[model samples]
Each structure stands twice: as C-alpha cells, then as structure tokens.
Target chain A: MQNTPHTPSPETSKQLPELFQLLQPHLKALDAFLETQISEFEPEIRDHVAYSMDTGGKRIRPSLIFFSGWNSEGEIDPNLVKLAAVVETVHLATLVHDDIMDEADIRRNRATVAKKYNNATAVLLGDALFSHAVYLATQFPTTEVCRDIAISMRQVCTGEIMQTMQRGDPNLDMETYFRVIDLKTAELFRVACHLGARLAGFEDDYVKAAGAFGRHLGIAYQIYDDMTDLFSSEEKIGKTLGTDIATGKPTMPLILMRDRLPENEAKALRDTLAGNIEADVPYWLEKLREMGIFEEVRQAIFDEIHKGRNAIRPFQNNPSAAHLHTISELLWNQVAAL
Target chain B: MQNTPHTPSPETSKQLPELFQLLQPHLKALDAFLETQISEFEPEIRDHVAYSMDTGGKRIRPSLIFFSGWNSEGEIDPNLVKLAAVVETVHLATLVHDDIMDEADIRRNRATVAKKYNNATAVLLGDALFSHAVYLATQFPTTEVCRDIAISMRQVCTGEIMQTMQRGDPNLDMETYFRVIDLKTAELFRVACHLGARLAGFEDDYVKAAGAFGRHLGIAYQIYDDMTDLFSSEEKIGKTLGTDIATGKPTMPLILMRDRLPENEAKALRDTLAGNIEADVPYWLEKLREMGIFEEVRQAIFDEIHKGRNAIRPFQNNPSAAHLHTISELLWNQVAAL
Candidate 1:
C-alpha cells in the first residue's frame, strides 16, 4: 500500500478525454463486424446481447490484445480484431452469469441482463456469448493462441468458483484473495496481451512484455476496484460502495486492516464480516470505520495503482501502445482522485 | 406415452447396435477431443468436468445435428464436427446443472457431477461447460450458424426453468408438458439439426426437413423416455425406475392415471406428488400399476416413435442420416417391447 488515500491528490491523477476519440475508428469497425455476425438471431436475444456488449465497456482488454500484438509484431492485423471480439465476449459471459450468481440488480448503471430479462434467460444468453467466444478463438491466426485463450477461459471459471467460496468469509487470506483476483480479474487481461502478441506472431520477448504489462495493469485495475468498493460514489462509481463489506468478503483493505487490528477490535471486524447482509448496515459500517481499517485499505489501493503505473513506464514511447498505457494511468489517477 | 408394462421386457426390446457401432468412430474422436481440451486444467477440476462428459450417455443431440446435415446435404463434412461437439456440450451442461437442481445422486449408473463434486463446484462446472460450449460454437464457419445455435441454446435454458416450475404437479397439462419437453429436450435436438443443415449449406427445403425431423424425433425421444421410466430393467435403464415420479413430474401414464383414478387413489397420487421424495415409492408404484397406467403410456410411446420414424424417413438415402432414422426406430421398438 502507498501513502496516498482512495481519494488521490491531483498530482498523481491524469485525464484522457480524447482516448475514446483515438480508439473510435477501430471500435466502430468492431461494432459493425459484431452486428453483421449477430444479426441473424431471434431479434430480442441478439439485441439484448449486443446491448450488453456495446454497453460501452472500457475496451481495456481489447486494447491490450490489439496493442500488445502491434508492439510485438509492428501491426494490428485483422486477426487482432477477431481475438478482441472473442476476449470481450468471454468477459461479457462472466458478467451475465455473475449477475445471476450474485443476484446483483444493477451494473454499469443499468439493470443487469439477469435482472432485466430474468436469470434463466441471462444464463442462456451468457452461454450464447461463451459459445461465440470459443468459436471465434479458432479464428485467431494460430492454434497456439486458440489453445492459450481457451485455457485462460477455464482459469476464469476456476477463479469465479474460488471467489464464490471466498465471498462472505472474513477469514479469507491475502494469498487466496490474490489467487482469486488473478484469475477473476487478471487472467483475461494477461491473455488479452498474449492473444494480441500471439496474433502478431510475436513469439518471444514481446509476448513476455505484453503479458507483463497486462499483469501490472490488471493489478492496478483490481486495486481500483477495491478502492471503488470502499470510497467511490454511487453516481460516479456506478454501484453501491463497500459492496464487498456488505457481502462480507475480506477485500484488500479489510485484509490489511485485520492484520493491523487490536485483538478486541479485530473480533469486532470479524463479527461484522460474519454477520448477515440483511442486518443493520450503519452499525457495521461504523464498526469497520471505528477500527481505522478503511483508511489502511484506501491507502493500499493507491499504492497498487502507483506500482501499476511505474510498471508500464518502459512502454510509453510506443505510440501504437499509447492508448492502453494511457488508460491504465488515467484509471489509476481517477481512483486516486475518488 | 405407450403400452409397455412395469416389468422387465428385454425379450422384445430393439437395439441400435449397428447405428451405435457407426457412431463409435466419432464417439472416439469426441473422447480424444475432450481429453485434449480439458487436459491442461488441474486434475481435480479436469476430473470434475470429465466425469460428466466422459460418461457414455446417449449423444442424441449431436447425432441429430450431424444427421441433419448428412440427410439434407448428403454428407457429413468434417468441418461440422465441432458444431456437433458444441451442441453435445450444451446438452451436458444442462444435465450437470439439472442434476444439482434435482439433487440426483446418480445419472447413467454413476454419480452425477454434482454428486461427485460439491454443489458449489458442480454449479460452476456447469457454467464452465456452458462457457466452453459457447467458445466452441464461435468456430462455426458462418455467422448465421452462430446466431441460430445461440437461439437454440436459449430455448434449452428456458425449457429447464419450465420443467423446474412444473415439477411434482400431476395437474401439469399435456400442452405445457409438450412445450417443456420441446424446450428442454427438443430445442437442442432441433438446433443440432439446424446446425447440421446450416453447415452443409442446404439453404432450401432441406433445412425445413432437417428441422421437422429433429423436432419430431425429439418428441418421440421424450415419449420413449416416459416409457423407459416405468418399464425397463433397472440394469438396462441405468438408474432407478419411476425417478421422475419420485421427483413429482407427471409423465404420460401418471397424467392419464390421474384422470382415470378412483377418487381416493387419485387423491393419494396427488398427495405423493405434492409430498417429499421420502414418500414410499413402492406404494405409488403399486397403485399406479393397479390402474394400468404403464400400459397406456407405453402404447403412446410407440405411437410417437413410429411417427418420428416416418418423419425422418426422407433422409434414408444418406448413410449417417439413415442411421438416425434407424436409431429412432430401434429406441422406439425398445420402449414398445418394454
């Protein structure tokens, strides 16, 4: 963890108003390609699926997949776009199912597919997305990328299962948390890099570079997730705050705080974690804050994002890779500001 | 439902010995492909998934898909192999999830994935299979194939939900049952056919024939399932008899028997359906037999299967398509014998 809080000082944070503009042409073509691909379905299913896909998700993973390839192989080939679509579809499938498993009512400020259409429909739709992803991975230029992407997907499932078990467990260790995060959050990002690089036929050092960049950015991205859970506004962050606490998952901040707690205070924190979500929220929040655990967690998030930015400093000169590098820095800056 | 009695009747049963033999080659391929795809995961997770797929359950859906192509287009292209594989995986995903939802200890004479693994793992494993199926489907050569497959997969999920809600209700109308069966079992079969026809690029009346064949066969298949539940050998059946009754879902005979039952007996049957699985199985079986419901159901099973054979007969010239037609007849013959 760093000295900065969840609300970072202006000096560390940056902005990227033109980033979307920069990526617009490729994004447009990607959307057009997907539209043509999906237009033949039962209209409602296709519309709902595309609605989720084009929900303007930060194209972070796809960008990594694209840029990693370009940096490694010196061009963004047609294969990168297809791989991008596949990776994004895989991510979308997880979100659709996660909403059902979590019973989450809202995501990205919209009714989740599970909430909007219904769980059964959501499950099927998610399966549809997943099926599309697997089918598309073969479109990648090589069998190697196909195999790696598919393996990463199974790893995502492993991560989801691991996370499901860890939920509501205050005693969850940091190792388990990282293991889960790495799978749930980082595996795709890591794969995104590898896929991009692989598509470019960048067989060695560049592949490692792409993967390393994604790994650090993914860590930074997740630390931002932790910070958002604790400190971001519902309007700005797009969901409820302290949701992890509400769900009783011992997230990074909470984990750091538990270790630092006095025995009696730690027991209080543990009790709150073990308590049912249907119980009193204010009482639990007060207890958590009274223990000074929240502040420690806030700082830990900033430190991770800071480390993430530093990790990418080596790739700044590559203009083709600039958007991805910029987004990582911007997200971290926003987390610090928040 | 048709006229088979609630006793061993192996002497009259028909077998798909030759068709199953023809399918043997592809079955081997399926096994090898599954091994390669899952071999990379940790052994524990790999085994959990493999236990479900590796079980030598019927490959009805895949056969339908391949045969649909074989019949309409005159040959089963090797390229369409993965399409069949994906459809089967979708079916297996539904079954794995169904086992958990049903809490069944056994399927195909062995423990289900849920029974073998804990419920949490089993649930996620089902999700993984669904994801993997989607991933696999993306490899289809055309976008329409992708969208059509997705639509069919959606139907399967909806069918499962319908079945769950209708479980244990003797009053479940036959129309509702038909719809449920169509969604749960028939839709995938239809998709399999649709995929087969789509891949073969039949692009005409052939598509309609393939779909019609699949839909009718799927219905016949479910009808035969009803007969098998009441009349087949415990060993031959691979699981306990009258399990659906135990779960409270009214099959054809039960539905008929409910209407035919003397007031007291009808009330008793209804009570059992509404009650827990702990209710005496023998008691219901005895009462059900006294009404001759089993015989009535078996006759109906024959009627449907015979209809299915007629529907699929147009494909008789193609070897793979001919086998599906023959298998449908044989399966029906087995039910009629029972």
Candidate 2:
C-alpha cells in the first residue's frame, strides 16, 4: 500500500454541501419518484415504507448515480430518477433488515423499523422493499441493469452472512475485514456506478473507470464509518455508536488493535468482549483511544481515500469527473477530523 | 363459489405416489442442481442453507416447473433444472423468512432456520438465497422470466403485508382473504408455470392454461393448508400447528365459522380470539369442530380442487396435464383426511 499524506483540509469538506446545493433538484426528483413507486403498496406497508424512506440520510448512492449519469454528455435520462429510487430503496431495505439483526433502536435519530413496529413486520417490510426494488429494476428496457443489481444484491447478502458468521471474533484478520467490506459496501457502490454509466450510454472503458472509483471510495467510506462508530460521540453521529464492539462485530479498528496488542492484553480484551462487558465498554473504548489506535485508523482511511482519488485522477480535469474527485476529498476531510 | 361434489376418491389420490415413483429420477436431478447452486455460498452459510434445503417438503414448486417444462413436444432444456432450483430456492428463502416472522420452530419435522440458526443469520441466509435465485433467473437468455420472478416475488410480499395488516381481525372478508392468497400463494404458482412453460417452448395458450392450473391450485392448496393447520395433529403435519391462532392470523376456517355463527356467538368467539385466550384454544377448537366447521372447510377445499382441475380441463387428456391434475388431487387428499 502506498502511503501518501494527501489528507484533505477543512475547506475540502465544504465542497460537498455546495455540490448538494447544485444537486438538490435531482434529489427532489428522486424523492418524488420514490414516493410514487412506494404508493402502490398496501396502505399499512406504504406507511412503514414511507417512514423508512423519509428518514433522512446523506443520499450518497443517489448522488453517485446522478453524477455518473451526468457524465454521459447527453441529457440525463428521466429514467435515472427511477433508478435512483431503486438503489436508495435497496439501501433502505438493507438498513431495515440490519437494524433488526443488530437489535438497534435508533437510526438517524429515530426508532428503527423493528422497534417502531415489530420484528415480524420489519422482516416482511424489508422483503417487500427488496422485491419492489427488483421489480423497479425490471422496468428498464435492458436486462443488464437487472443482472448487475441482482449480482450486487447477492454480494451484499454474502457480506452480511460473512460478517454474521465472523461475529465475536476479535482476532479477525485485516484481509477478511477488507473482504467483508468489499462485498458489503463496495459492491453496491461499484454497481451504482456501473448502472449509472451504462444507463447514461457511456462506453465500456469509462464505465469500468467509474466502477473502480466507486469500489475504492466505498471501501474508504466504510473504514471511515467504522472509525466514527468507535471514536465519535453518539450525539455527534445521531445514531447508535460503539455498537461494533457491543455486538462483537469485527471492524477495522478492532482488528488492527487486536493485531498490535500484546498477546495477554489481546486475550483479555477478547475475554471481556465474550463476557458480559456491555457496561464495561466505555473503559475499553477509553483504553483503545489512549493507545492511539484511532490515529492508525485515520491513517488507514487516508490511504484508502488517496487510492480512491488516484483511480479517477486521469479524468480529474473533466468538470464532471472533478465533482467525483471532490466527493472523495469531502469524504477524506470528514474522516480526517477523527 | 360453485359447490360441486366432484371430490377425488382414494384411487385418484394413489396416482400421485405412482407418478412420483416414475419422476424420482427428475426429482433427484433437481436435488443435485439445488446442491450445486448452494455450494457457492460460504461454509457457514452453506451449512445453514443446506440444512434448510435438506429438511425437505413435497417439492411441489419444482414439480410444477418440471411437469410444465415437460409439456413441450420437444426435448427438455437442461436449463430447466436450473430454473427448478431457482424456484425451489425462492420457495426455501420465503419459508426461512416466514419462519422468523412466525417464530416457528418446526417445519418438515425439523427445526426451522430461525430455530436452528439465530434470527439474524436466518434473515441474511434468506436474503442470500433470494439474491441467488434472482441471479439464477438472470442466467436465462430472455428478460421475461426475470421480470416474472421479480413481479411474483413482490406480489408474494404484498400478500404477506396484507396478511400482517389484517392480523387479529376475525371479520376479514372472503374477498380480501382470497386476494391475499392470490397475491401470496397463487402468484408464485402462476410464475412457476409461466416460467416452466415458457422455458419448454410451449404455445401461449398452453402456458396460460398451465398458469391457471397453478394459480387455482395454489389458492386451493393454501386453503387446504390453513385447514390442516387448524385441524391436523402436529405430529402428523410435522410442523408447528395452531400458530395461526396464536399469532392472530385470519384463515379460512375461522372466517367461515365466524360468518356462519349467530352474531352473539361470533362476537364472543372474536372476543376470545382478541383477548388472552391461549389456554382456551382447546375449548374454541372443540366448539368449532362441534359446529361442523371442519366439514364446511373440507367442502370448500373440494370446491377449490374442482375449479383448479377445471382450469386445465382443456388439456386433461395430455399426459403432462393429467399429472398436474393428479398433483392437485394429492394435495386435496392430504387435507381431506384432516
């Protein structure tokens, strides 16, 4: 791995907000399309689906789709909005099921679907959303998008299954950790770009490049997210924080820390995790912080971000490609604060 | 609606087992294909998936696909085996998720996925299976089968959502009940036939007839299933029984009995259902049985069978179509004894 000190400054973070401002109209269109798509469901399901959809997020996937679609040098397809809804609904469906699996209460400062209704309703609701997303993908004239979506979906579930299987293993290797993230996070990003570029009628090379950019960016984003979950305050994140340890989920920081620690201390930490240490989590968190593991995690995030930016460096001069670069930089700036 | 007394005799029911004897080789081929399909998953997931798959049911969906595929007056495509696996996997995925939603323990005389594994693992496994099934569907040349699968999947979920919404409502109308079964049960059956016939290069009319056969048979199967759940011994059914009542699920017998009883008695029964009457279930079951609700339910099952068989009556002389009719009768025989 090439180590480059290309961390973004605070000013780099402001660019995304401006981009968001420029892209606000497209986002609104996606929102409307999503609402209309979900309206066909039964009234009860419609309410639950709307509730989950309306729970605001950064809309990162839609931005990727929109930006990638805009790169085609043609008028963006109206169908792109529908595609955005499909991807976002897919994202939302995964989150709903994730919340249930994690037994999480709050997400985006609100009760999770599993908590809001019940597990049974939440499970069926997730299934319904997934089916709806698949159906939406089928509306496209080509089977290519549906094929990509299906493969990406399978990979996502594979990641989840891998993660579930490896839960509580603090000694999980960095390779396995990266593999999990690659499947779980990066595959969706890769397909989002793949779909966006293909739908925009881009040639095969640019589509491949776009997918690479997304893959690296997604890996970087997930590493940064794992770091934030460990280091940031629950209030700052506006959702459940430090849950990776509590749930015995093997994430980057834990894997790194376990690898670096003395054998006895690593075993002790694992024992604590294996035991009823829910109340003792703060102590472990403080110890890991005092050990400066967060600094190492931050460095790892920067390395990933640098790799992500370099993948798209060839097209950085293009205005549309520059926007993608700026998004990567913005992600770096957010993680640098940790 | 037509109360025809065209019930099958024991001799007709006996034909299915003989057919199964002849079709054993095809069933084994399907089983082998299913194994290969699931073998691609991670070891942990592979075990869970295999465990769930091996805890066999009657292979009804695959039989539908196979019988329909064989309808063409030409050689059967090797791809049909993969399609059978896809449909069966889809069926298995739904059952896994449904078990989690129902908190069911036993299925096919063994522990359910949710019981054998944890709910989280079971949920992810179900999702992985669904994705795998979709991926398998995409392997075909045409987009039509994928679209049908996606739509059928969405409709199935819609039915589940409708059923979830109407839970505990003893006054669920017959029309709405039929609609739920149509969406949840019949859609898959319809799609199974549609795909099978399409794959076999059957004519459009035969395809339509096969789908009709599957749809009406699916509705009849669900009705018979609900009746079996109400009246059969758990040891005989080899699955958890009486869960519909415990979960407040509205099924045919309850609906029919409630509609047939005196208003005051119906209200009392509904109150008992709505309130804490877990221990009083035996008393309610006795009352319904004493009221000859089982007889009414049996008659309803026979009526549905008549309609199901009638849907494919045009091709009754064809060997393939006769097998379809025999399958429906077999399902009827199982529930008739209840």
Candidate 3:
C-alpha cells in the first residue's frame, strides 16, 4: 500500500464533498481491489458486475470502516480496505435489488441495473454480487468477518422485506419506520465499524463503542436520505425525487405530515398512500413545507448524530475516535445544509 | 445423531422414490435442522422463511453430502448434517430467485416462493436465505466449508446469469449449455460431496473423487431435468410443461432438434427460438419425438452418469464409494424411466 494517501481527481473530488478528501486513498484502494474482483466472476457477466460496482455512491460505509480503524501513523490497513470492499459490495447488491423493487430508472445519474439490463438480469446480477461479497468475506484468516457479514446481510434483507410488507399501508408507525431503517441500513454500518475496529487491533470496549456510533450514524444518514427523496431537487441529487409518496413508501416526513394533517386531509393522504387514489407529489411536498416537517426531520437526524458522537466521546484521546467525530460532523453539516 | 437410519414416513417415501430410503435419517435431521433455522430469521419474515424451506423438493444435494460422508457404522455426523443444511439452504435460495426469473408459478406441486409472495418479497427473501446459508457455513471449526461454499455460490449465480443471458438466443451451442449447467447445478453438488467427504475424514484422493462424481452427476441431472420440460406431462411433472420452447430457452433437446432439422425447417425453428415467430410447442414436441432426440438426450444423460460412476470406481473398497455408486444408479434409473 502507498504510504501517502492519494489525491482524488478533480472530477471525483467534485462528485464527493470536501470532507471526503481524507478517504481518497482508502477509497482508491477499494476501487482497485474491487476492479480486480471483476475477473473473479464468470466471463459472461463480468461487465454487469463491474457496472454495479461502479455506482459511485457516497461510500458512507467505507468511510465508517476507515475512520473507525484509523491509525495515528496514517498508514492504511489493507485489511480495512478489504472489509470496505465487502461491505460496499453488499450495499451495491442491495441497491441493485432495491432498484428493481422501486421500478427505479436512474441512480447516480445513470440508468439503474434493472433499467439498463432487465429485471430478471438485475435480480440474478444482484445475487451474483452478493455471492461475490460473501466469497470475499471468507478470504479472511478467521470466520469472524464472514460470520458478521452474513448476519448483517440477513438483517439487511429482513429490513427490506419488512419495508416491502409494509408498503402502501399508509398508517405505518414511526417505530416500524425506525426498525426498518435500523435493520436495512444501520445493520451494515454497525458491522462495518465493528469489524473494522476489531481488525485494526482495537480493544473490545472500543470496538463495541464504534459499533454503537455506527448504528446511530446509520439511522441519522437514512433519515436524511428519506428526507431527500421528498425535498431535494432531482437535478441536485442526480436521481428521481418525490418517489416516497409516489411509491407509497412511508418515510419520516410523510409519517409526520400525516399525523399533523386535518382529519379530512389526512384521510385523503392515507387514500393516496394506500393507492386508492393517485399520488399527488406536489401536494405532499407542499404539505411537508407548510407543516415544517422538513425542519423537524432535520432535527431528528441531528439528534441521532449527536448520540453517535457521544458514543465515542470517552475515547476522545484515541485518533480513531477523533476521526469518527469528524466524520459525524460532516454528516451533521450535510443534514444542516439540506 | 442417530446410530440407525430412520425409516422414511410413508407419505414422504411415496413422494420420493424408493431409492432414497437409505437417506431417511439424514434427510429427517436436515429437515429438523432447517426448521430450527426459521427462528433465526427476523420474526416478521420467519413464516415466509419456513414456507420457503418446506418446499420438499428432492434433496439431491443433501443426499450427496450424506452418501459421500457415509460411514460403515451408519452413524450420522452432525458436521455433515450442518453441511447438508448449508448447501440445501443455498439451493433453496437459488430456487426462490429462479422462480422469479422463470416466472414459474408452481414448484414441487405447490406455489413457488415468488408465486406465494410478491416478487419484491421473494427477491429479498432469497437474499435472506443466502445470508443465512453463509452464516451456517461459518459455524464450522475451520474456514474451508464457508470458503468453498462462498465460491460455489458465486459459481452458481454466474451460471444462472449465463443461462439468463442466453434465454432467447437460438445459436446457443452444446458447449454453453454444458457450461451453464455445470456452474448452476453442478457446483453445489460438487461442493456438497467435496465438503462432505472432507468432513468425514476421508482420504484426500477419495474426497477429490467424490467431488468429480458430483460434478458429472449434476450435469447429468440437469440434462434430465431439461428433457422432462419437453417430454413429460403436466400431471406427471406437476409443472407447466414445454416451457423451454415457449420461453425460448435452448436446452439439450432443442439444440439437438435444431441441428438435425433441414435448412428451411431449421430457419423457422431458429426464428421461433429467437422470438421472431410464435413457438409451436406441439410441432416441436412432435419433431423431438420423431427425430429420436429424446433417446439421444437420454444417452447424453447416461454418458454423464457413467462418467460420474467411473470417477469413484477406483475407491470401491470405501463404503462411501459404494453409497455414492448407489446414488448414481438412482439417477441412471430415473433417466431410464424418463
């Protein structure tokens, strides 16, 4: 591995925010490592596998893995890179499947795997990506990495399943929403941090703390993501917006807005969510702003981020804890800016 | 572990052929073990997981694990049982995904997971099953079982992807058909036997021989399955028959029949397979029967089975070799009967 972190290219840096510059080297290594894995798939589907891997997401999980395992010497641990790749691959596989479920056309400013290839190919290609992720996890010397990954993978799917089952129910409670996000999104984040810290030779207590931090951070990140679907511009986010209500997926803002609406308006909203009536995206987006649900959702995210920071507060002297704090601050800023 | 093999219940015995009676105890243990795994999934999805696990498809892969690990004393090895569960779960997960891609409604005389549940649920449910399988594989003392399983899972997905990609292509050759079947079907069989024999403390040579046997048998089994799709009645097979032709999937019989037809007929057949023209299932079935394609496909299957049997001929002194031989005989008989 290179001793000095590589600089991100201008295009790449522009895609990511300034806060992520510190992870350029680690993410670079992860990209090279993932590229090497393309040949590992069957020759027939290598291109599809490569396409899914190149989605260029924010790499939040990889950042969690890197910062949680930070070394004062600033030498990137190769094991952490591999762990990042494993978690990121799992994340990408979920995205592929998620696109199929959402009937989503675009992701990361390009056609989704489901739109580009077909739903059937997207489904199997996602499975192929998942199998490859587990295969990579097994390359570790011990079973801990694979075991944790398998459990997290299962939880992620379970969370998605719960969300699917609850779709169009309209009365979806905040607890269920939180539970789903915790499983679908936070579970991988927790495992990434836990495994990253453990692999970096951190103490047991610190590892546990890092996991808690990740779990809280994951919850916060997901809320922000859910908010963006209704609030962010399609051009700025590089994807379709206002899909939550359109697809009848009850998110934090929708739930809050529903609760605050007048009885007749709420029934109409419920009817729309239940698919009994057509979804009016503009109406819901206006309601969200009128009800101040956007600021409320942002505050909810801020609270979770603060909880995450408090998790590693006792380890303030540790360099990893400091890095983790900085990363949480970045999330806080993003949410605030939104 | 039971010291004596349990007799299969009459209902199960009737469902399965007489040849599987020797595996009653092992299959029973696997069923119980798999039932216990239902609780391992999230509470919300446990029923769905249980439903998927109880499909009662012929446990050919588990049988391979048991037979290859057979001891003269007939004592069940818990390790082999766990190994069987791992491979079986992976197979079930693949079946769940396969039903979605094939748009298959019924499997093993009942609705497939995809049919019973929505496609999105089926997709995530399949993912959960795959994750659980890897988790089970990681329970072994060493990384070998999990490592081998992960690799096999990737190969299986790759094979399925290749087959999916080849779905409407009239020009798919015999080599690609063999390769797809090898990856999609044969990989799990090979891994089951390989891991089963290795776990049974068999000699290295015997372990390798068992894996070879599994690969050939797997190839033979797939050819037999493809043949049945064209030749069998719905009452006998319990699935929609002649789907390969309708779906434009070029299997062994279709490939053979296409090659043997005269120029004009062959062009028409090619057009049908390419979706340029509607498939005439009755005509193709008639062609398959008249062209001696059924007998040729049977011969192809027999060749694979014979090769499989020959792989373990040198290890006849080992009881496992005899048991493995008996399993091959079962496949041989099934093909002959077909």
- Number of the top lDDT candidate: 3
Candidate models: Cα lDDT each: 0.66, 0.78, 0.87
Docking category of candidate 1: incorrect
Which candidate do you rate higher for lDDT, 1 or 3? Answer: 3
lDDT tens per residue, model 3, B71-190: 887778999999999999999999999899878898887899889989999999999999999999999988889989988988998898888889889999999999999999998899
What fraction of the reference structure's interface contacts does model 1 contain? 0.20
Q: After superposing candidate 2, which stretches have Cα over 4 Å from the reference? A: A1-4, A7-18, A42-44, A72-74, A239-241, A276-279, A316-320, B1-18, B42-44, B72-76, B233-235, B238-243, B316-319
For candidate 3, the per-residue lDDT at A137 reads 89
TM-score of each: 0.67, 0.91, 0.93
What lDDT tens digits, residue by residue, belong to model 1 across residues B45-92?
Answer: 676666778878677776666656654323336656787777777778
The local lDDT score (0 to 100) that residue A7 gets in candidate 1 is 43
Residue runs of model 1 more than 4 Å from their true location after superposition: A1-15, A33-38, A47-56, A66-81, A138-146, A200-204, A233-239, A276-317, B1-39, B43-89, B99-123, B131-219, B226-326
lDDT of 1: 0.66
Candidate 3: the clashing residue pairs are: none
